[model samples]
Target: MSHEHRHQSHPRIVARLKRAEGHLNAVVAMIEAGRPCLDVAQQLQAVESAIRSAKQTLIHDHVDHCLDARNSEAEREELKAITRYL
Candidate 1:
């Protein structure tokens, strides 16, 4: 596909990933500081959820833009690959 067909969610996904990175760093810091297990788990969960959301958004963009830019066979295979993520 051409560069013009690139997924539009790139920026949003990057932002979400950065937020998740921050949360993961905080989780590590909490563990190092001997913080409560529950608090650490909560932060870890937040990071996981953020990453998942970003992944879903990315997949949506791929379906909407990337796949549409490809041929039928490629699009079908890409759809299959996308379902594997679920």
Candidate 2:
């Protein structure tokens, strides 16, 4: 694949990831501050949800922008490999 591959969804995906990062940092702080376990767990779930959403969007963007009917077998394999992460 080309190193210069770009997708229209990339910017939004990045923003989502950055927000996830911030949430993850907050989760760590919550743990240190002795926050209630339920509160911490809920925040952790939110962080996980953010990251999962970003990953799904990124993978879909890749499939939309990078794959086609004429794609090679290797490309199809790559797609399958990425989907396994989900």
lDDT per residue (tens digit) for residues 5-71 in model 1: 4566798899999999999999999999999999999999999999999988878777666455446
**Number of clashing pairs per prediction, in order:** 0, 0
Query: Top lDDT: which candidate number?
Result: 2
CA lDDT of each prediction against the hidden true structure: 0.82, 0.86
| TM-scores for candidates 1 onward, in order | 0.83, 0.85
**What TM-score does model 1 achieve against the real structure?**
0.83
RMSD of model 2 against the true structure: 1.7
Off by over 4 Å in 2: none
Give the least accurate 10-residue stretch of model 2, judged by summed lDDT: 1-10
Clashes of 1: 0
